[model samples]
Target: MRKEKVHINIVVIGHVDSGKSTTTGHLIYKLGGIDKRVIERFEKEAAEMNKRSFKYAWVLDKLKAERERGITIDIALWKFETTKYYCTVIDAPGHRDFIKNMITGTSQADCAVLIIDSTTGGFEAGISKDGQTREHALLAFTLGVKQMICCCNKRVIERFEKEAAEMNKRSFKYAWVLDKLKAERERGITIDIALWKFETTKYYCTVIDAPGHRDFIKNMITGTSQADCAVLIIDSTTGGFEAGISKDGQTREHALLAFTLGVKQMICCCNKMDATTPKYSKARYDEIVKEVSSYLKKVGYNPDKIPFVPISGFEGDNMIERSTNLDWYKGPTLLEALDLIQEPKRPTDKPLRLPLQDVYKIGGIGTVPVGRVETGVLKPGMVVTFGPTGLTTEVKSVEMHHEALQEALPGDNVGFNVKNVAVKDLKRGFVASNSKEDPAKEAASFTSQVIIMNHPGQIGNGYAPVLDCHTSHIAVKFAEILTKIDRRSGKELEKEPKFLKNGDAGFVKMIPTKPMVVETFSEYPPLGRFAVRDMRQTVAVGVIKSVEKKDPTGAKVTKAAAKKK
Candidate 1:
């Protein structure tokens, strides 16, 4: 028998206390993938804590501080196999400090599932930092995905299973937060981990989960970039208004970001109808759909084209199971929605380009350059050159994880034997590719589209931040601000911004401390990539636009081959 190979790499993300772990656990169990030993251990632990209902999902609480604080601190990876696919669930922390990790994770995902909570309803008091929700939106815009879904969780308190009752209970709660919401009052506990899938018609998906909460916001950003699609989760009862407004506001922000990032479609889930009045749930769902539709309209999307669904992840009602509770509601369930998502198009035939993620020494291997292969094929005996240092190497061998391979190409994770290159010779932010195909060299002047993050407090004309390009990190300063453009419309924001702010997206010229490989976005996206970082955090992301021409100094000599030709 063929080793039954179907893999779906997906992530879970959202505001904190939105039940990311719980939802993830539920999916594992619902799919019959959880081990009995793990469940028993969790039961024993829950018994000690006096919460019998706590299942194996608690095992996901890996960190001591996370368990105590009820928050995710790091991104966790788990695996489960279905009749149709083997899935890897990446659980990312919702905190702000972990945003870098989140970006890393998002860059690896193919699709995403965004979670929201019903208890707190929406953006709670003190739940954000410097308008982090807005930041999340901005980051999501960079993660060009196709499918976006939303889930509203935690209506379990009402105990109403009827669709009508859930609708009634949903409308009772409203006006929680919006512009007045701060970053302090947001709960850190996740009540459920919602799931959604985005599919494109072209390539298999790698999904991401961005859970809410200051702790896991990083996870959301990282997860989103890797995904080709995404989903939003909301609670049907308590989530009605919360999902419609505060939570809805955030959803719009994220959705808008996704749209800006090139996401083509999305699905919204109204979870937890089992514990709410059918009337409240229905009313809430209607209201939420209307609000989301109106927002989409304002943002240039047709209102009638929006997709929303209602379900309860906890009770397994309308999630993967067909609930007897809603015979009146005729539509596909959450699972069906997931199944319906089409995979994104794969630009595998595009030019060979690799984003240098890291350069490290591996014992006998000397120096190793690690990064995801964005396009084309990597083969042995092929001569490749990395950024600026312009070190040329012959591909002696290729290895991934540990397995040896003759050649690796797009989507393959492998390392090459770069002879004569030393640990000190190669650093992060350098790319290794066939020099014959790529232009890996320093440019004096280049246009770049940058999303400015946090810049240094003491600003100056020549202040430089550590630039993160693929795996290479070097000191780079903005040489000039050619023009500022609207992040959304690409319309000019300012002819020049002396100082770019937190959410600004504009084009500018930069100078690197050292000569490094840089290229125009049109020619080599891999070498064109870069990120800005202060000592504390990542400040921005960008791609080189074009290179400025320089004057030739050396005496020109005609090549013998050229003369002969």
Candidate 2:
């Protein structure tokens, strides 16, 4: 008896110069050998196309059959059958322009094949120079396969392991951190956020390990925005320390971001202490602390108050226990420094401000708006007002993962069904707040303190760029350049500067291109701090100092909300 063939979907992805198309075509061409005559026909077809006898043109011969020459933007699908399974392959384009197609292909793929040129300069042509191998990262994040989340290196522990196993020597030191998500550790890089909550000596701690991957900078913003304290990890080895703290390093960038995003408290861990030339050298540790402290001061942090803890993450020295290797150091261990952090007051007592992440209409549920509560509490009986249009509705039910809750607090992502609210009436950017208490409205214009971190060109009045605040992404115009200010002191530096260049801090008045809900940093923090996104990168970051709100006009109120009022 013959058995039925199972179906499989494979996606081919890589950098533009990485021969994705060539690899895909070769696979199909070789599979053509399954039918011996088909291979001969392909050779005949190839010979006819390359009658010019150009060996260099032979590279284009196979693609010519597919009718695509230079850089195929669209995904090409092909089919072939094996003895046990039927396979469908998608030739997903590798260029950034075709990211949507790549995302589409990646999501549908049962397996993804990343093609590499492997040749000298061909490998250097794209992608890899930056820390991320974006192809594998896209696949890992999209599929959420392999949990790649055991902090992706437990960064190698859910329970911190004591020094054990002689095999866990030299490079094996980090084996424990990567052991949890062993597969990704083979890549030897953690390209994404590693969020793990564990109790320290004094407080329950959440470590949002924001690795310095340029592609995931937005993740850094999101992680630091919620953090009460930032754990700054640094390389203490000879060249490693210099490379990490240099102008091009991401450590300085992250520190600046953390300070800008309101992570007032921080613990600077001088990591890889064991790897120092003389082994846990106090001289090396002091040198790093001196340089980092000066850099932190420029970023607006009071370096004197920030604790510098020396530790080796790989060797597990001074992370939880004091390192005898460095008896010269008297400071508390990593865990002890964490215990010193003073908890910031929770915003639950403030007026409710929940930025909608998504809106959905279910079979039985009317309209559900899902978001994390940035402040205050959300309950079933409350009258909710959505900003921009001031659409009002009464919350019929509040649920987290299909289970009803009495109230949802800050940081709780919940989907609440609203009475008389249609799906069209809500969207991701809209702010949901208590109807009768400090309700959110659209902003006409706002004043903000913006620091240009990375911009290809100068930013001046009338330069409109997309601003990412909370769940909203809107183009906001720089209405006026008020004054350039000293980053550390916030003192006026220049009056109405012609333009703000990279690393310049200035007060600017902004006008949104569309309806956007924003509040002063003092009032609603999550909605106040925004990333100035331009050219597909976070060119600048700003904190809303003040807002001029537009009064609501002809706003819609649900029947349920009206009756309650």
Candidate 3:
């Protein structure tokens, strides 16, 4: 009688730079080998990629190199054979965003391999100092992974109950991570956004591919505030689409936020068509399109203009090339639709409005302010004005990543030395602009169209919350509710509503509690969108419709700036 092979799932986890992937690769090479067919598959791919070597080791080395360079391979499982069993390994990334993925991966694990870098400060910086390492261990123990092998450098230590107890005890201090983990268990897949760079036949595009709804306020609001197009990737499986489009799901929120934040173009990609019932059912596609188009219309996007592309992200169907699987539907491939998007007009001709993120005082350099140029152009030796107090100074030099730049355009984060501004004179939240043009000023009050997303109580007059806009965080009070309008049509519903509740869309005038610069969304978009944060969470988001500028006088003009005119 032939002996049967036992199958096991293993999760490999560790802190950043702890060589978890390296150790996993080493084990795969040493303990066992992959299937012959799998090796041949890799060899075929290698040949197609023009690699001369057909060895399995070379393919593993290539994957390792990709991982070392911080390119995430999305491969959730790696199968290999041990002398005793067939092992399926899940190697988790050492980061905050992938914690959910780690947990999901760990839940299936029969055993876990914890890799720790024992070299000098590496151990201290990785385990003792990093909360993610502790979180990973805690999750492994909590998820009931039957066994664990701790690989510290070369030596391996197997400890079962005692190690679990230690992990449980040491991780009590990270109560925040614990709470988040608990919430994640309840909420399911909350993901982070990634900037995808791809080249089509027409345009070289940078896509802000959002992962999920949770923490989107911090990511989309705080980072990558602008996008030309929003691609809503839908799950086409039986229950996958329902879960995603459900309340508190990523689909609805992402679409709503994208529309509200002024993404001009939208693409609804019905993905995973290969896994759909009956395999690429046009009925399923039509049903999803019908449902999604209506939902998007509610979110203020004209569904007529949006492209609904059916694709299997995994099966390569209708993603780049045409697939016969989805032959019944012919609209556009994901790549084709991406190319069809109208290119956004670059905001280079507008007045310079660079909001200061931080002001640094270097040893050799006097005073330097680092910020992203939101509009117009920033060049060396231009007279730049700092807003709110209207402190004017000449740009001594402009540099990005220590390299000197002739000019910085919109979206370029650069640091420039100023002619005669002290460190105390400039700070975060101050706007830098062309002194000669219509410069930014302190906002006395701004009227905005606000959509309350999350709030425990009603918001009325005198309700002040911190507004995060363009590297600025300052409390702004709801001075008055101008009107409550239908979010989709922007048509007036109620005049001067006394109180605004969650999911209510209203035009409100806001007064900042401190000196802050804001611009109209029609002009400077980066300076216009604001997130309302209260009680340590984002409660609402708004776009500035109009700004009442406070004319600043007695402004200090630096000697170099004064001489420019």
Report the lDDT tens digits of candidate 1 across residue range 412-464: 44456666666676664455556676535555667788876455453334668
Q: For this target, which candidate reaches the highest TM-score against the unseen true structure?
A: 1
- Pairs with backbone N, CA or C atoms under 3 Å apart (clashes), candidate 2: 150-154, 153-177, 156-176, 156-177
Report the Cα lDDT for candidate 3.
0.49
Candidate 2 or 1, higher TM-score: 1
**Model 2 Cα lDDT, one tens digit per residue, 387-429:** 9889998999997535598987664446899998779989867
Candidate 2 whole-model C-alpha lDDT, 0 to 1: 0.49
Residue 156 lDDT (model 2): 15
Residue 532 deviation, candidate 2, in Å? 3.4
Put the candidates in TM-score order, highest first: 1, 2, 3
lDDT of each: 0.45, 0.49, 0.49
Error of model 1, residue 30, in angstroms: 2.7
RMSD of each: 9.7, 17.0, 17.0
| lDDT, residue 17, candidate 1 | 39
lDDT of 1 at 336: 57
lDDT of 1 at 68: 34
RMSD (Cα, Å) of candidate 2? 17.0
